[model samples]
Target: MAKDDMDKQPDSVSSVLKVFGILQALGEEREHGITELSQRVMMSKSTVYRFLQTMKSLGYVSQEGESEKYALTMKLFELGAKALQNVDLIRSADIQMRELSRQTRETIHLGALEEDSIVYIHKIDSLYNLRMYSRIGRRNPLYSTAIGKVLLAWRDRHEAEEILSHVVFTPSTARTLTSKEALLSALDKVHSQGFGEDNEEQEEGLRCIAVPVFDRFGVVIAGLSLSFPTIRFSEEGKSGYVKMLHEAARRISEQMGYHSYPF
Candidate 1:
């Protein structure tokens, strides 16, 4: 009986994988009708419709206007936001982020690793005329931004290589690091210096400095960053900004019950 149950587990797991694949396909295509979704998932139309109906009932999927096309519902965002709020790092760092912005008069952001991307969970916008614009819930490439680099730099070498394998280094600007080796070297510097810099790598004319926020186990849980316009701060000024950013991140990590490091 135990052997039979073990053997049946693979079929159950495969069913879950298939459902996840269907959801991924729908997400990639943004919106797809039943026929297209069936073809995309390599499942029959009846099977796809049944699974989609189940998902729709669970609030994970929704139909479009009078059409049979399916799209992800806002329920995912609601769940995700609740999860983020419960994260100790985000809760601990919220006050530090506000303080960082108050002191520097620049935008401060908090991000965490989400699969192959970085998800922004909290932000304090700058009160300036030419501040950068980034939504709180957006995801950005991990290899192209300061906050992403700080999180990546905390990973082991082998894990970093594995994560970088999925990253395509499309140059957002001329200063963007395009080569894997270059990114690796930059990560090394970030690890050594306890901070990272985005010199218009993600956006033109904007500069950002970031530091990792570690958990009680010394593992990176999130990243804190401050962003400003390049025209406002020279290289020396940016370096000073990095110093302040690292200090703020250290305070946040301490508030999160991480006390082992002497930061």
Candidate 2:
């Protein structure tokens, strides 16, 4: 934007824009002195130095000792790596979720652990009008959902416990596991069985089945799940749905570069 327009923005907004400008300029070179950076971002030397100081303090930029030059840090690259991972995962999961939708005529979801909850990143709606209500970006409790169980099931016991230590186990339904001890037991069962079951724990009359999708390092990065209503769920048919979800998750894990799918 023009300098005049930028000047009219809220001070907080303008400061953020200036910070990004400085960071972008620094990214184009290994290092930059204040004079060069200010010239590149069309800001004054004092403004550039002030932002650089803040960034440096935050570990996003580094200053050469005894020099007036600043450089980008590895911290930004680490943040980008996390975002790029999710992008690649979704790109690879789209076709697989679609194929599962075509065969099962049920809702399919791709979810990943964010903090202590599972967030849906991608979804394919069921072909039937009676399907469950859900959307991408929805957050579901780890103690009550199939995708959530699959996400925590593959983690180390101590790590999983640590992650859940701060969570409030609010029950979503009468069947929901409302305590850490109970949820941890369910996670153990999920780990042993190679899949997870919601069984109306998340929502009354709705059931879900899930399997893990791994990354190149065999880390369980996401969960692939199929949601159904209790009316359509059966002990016999549950096996078939689990089989399909496992196959789909295995292929998705392969697409993410992990070859040895455990299940």
Candidate 3:
């Protein structure tokens, strides 16, 4: 809504605005006292204090002592760092993904785990006339995609199981894993081999291979994959393509502050 419309908003919305205003004012300096902050944000001292107390309890704000000033905590900084890392990851992955496209002439995709699916964040189209049909922002089933399998495989066994528990396990193709047990078995292989594959599981006659991209904390935050048609796939070329993907993913992960590449 417009700024003028916001003025006519309900009390809840006004309170939210006041809270954010106070936060913005506090962010301008290292610390702020209740009265000083209230004046800056045009809020009452008691109201500001109430919000500060609530924020402090929530770990968004902190106070040194009962008499000291309120200050913004590291939580906001942590959240911002995560967002920045994702942006940098995509930027770095773009170059590597493009390189892979040139080398193999296949569709390249970078996917991140969302609530219960893998969302494509970036992609490079194949040079050939026959190519995988996919788009950025498309959500693919985690149980049937190479990227999704890699994402799940990198997590703890129990955690991976818990995540799959929420999946409905709808088989998109005849080859798709239709049970949690089967998916878990595939994940075991993915973990052991340090890569994942979709052999006509998501779509008939399509195959995909993916490797994990790690973050600064060495956690798999994304999956990078190459897609191909069965006609274009070769048993001997599988290992070569996997090596290329691993190299690309390693470089991208290193750029994202992860130095130890698993493969």
Candidate 4:
């Protein structure tokens, strides 16, 4: 009986995968007719139409007028925005992030761990011409950059090792750490100091300081980072900037009702 059940599981999983593939194909193209979606997903027209009907019933996909084409509905964004708003940490930290940018006169970013990468949720641009180029929807590797390091430092050693198992460490610049051992050592320093530094690791001529932001439950929910040009901060100046960054992160965490962890 157990063997029979296990055999049926693969078929069920394959059906789910096919449905998701059809949805993804529709999302990539602005609007896809039945023929186009069937070709893109390598499924028959009948199968594609059935999947589209189901998705439309769920409000995940919609049909265009008289064209027999399907497009994604706005329901996905409504769901995503609701989830973002429900995160107490993000809601509480917005004002503090603005203040951090005002005080440091540098670009400030708020990022959260998404799967194996960090996704930027908010950004405050620097007043100067030279600044980090990151948009709100950008995702970067978790093994590089200050924000990534700070978030990784908060995880347990076992969890960190697991997360790093599949990370590609291609060197972005001469200063980028390409070895797992070197990254683990940096994580150790970030854990001890309660902050992380990126000395032109992601891009040449740019430096960033980052600290972890925790929620009321004491779990690291996101990272707050201040980025600027390397020419503006000497080694001594970098230390001062690290202090300011740590302080700003602490204040944001406090506003989020996180009082258990001391930085």
Candidate 1 has what TM-score?
A: 0.68
lDDT of 1 by residue, 1-263 (tens): 23344346678775686678678887787799999887777777998898899999999999998988999888878877758644766777878888887788888999988888899989999978777889888999888899899888989989989888878888988998898889998898888887888888999888888888877678887888888888887876777777777788788877767876434
Shift of residue 36 alpha carbon in model 4, Å: 32
Best by TM-score: 2
Candidate 1, superposed: residue stretches over 4 Å from native: 1-86
**Model 2: which ten-residue window has the lowest total lDDT?**
1-10
lDDT of 4 by residue, 1-263 (tens): 23344346677775787787887887787999999888887778998899899989999999999999899999988878647643666667677778877777889888888778899988888988777789997998776788999889989989988888888899989989997789998899899987888888898998888888887677787888888887887777777777776677787777767776566
Provide backbone clash counts, one per model: 0, 0, 0, 0
Q: State the weakest 10-residue window (summed lDDT) of model 1.
A: 1-10
**Each prediction's TM-score versus the true structure:** 0.68, 0.88, 0.78, 0.68
Residue pairs with colliding backbones in model 2 are none
Q: Tell how far residue 154 is off in model 2, in angstroms.
A: 1.1
Better of 1 and 2 by TM-score: 2
CA deviation > 4 Å runs, candidate 2:
33-50, 53-58, 65-69
lDDT of 2 by residue, 74-135 (tens): 99999899899999999999999999999999999999999999999999999988978888
lDDT of 3 by residue, 1-263 (tens): 34466568898998798778878887899899988987887667898899999999999999978866999999988989877877898999999999999999999999999888999999999999998889999999999999999999989999988888878999988999999899889898999998999999999999999999998899999999999999999999999999999999999989988899988
**lDDT of each structure?**
0.83, 0.92, 0.91, 0.82
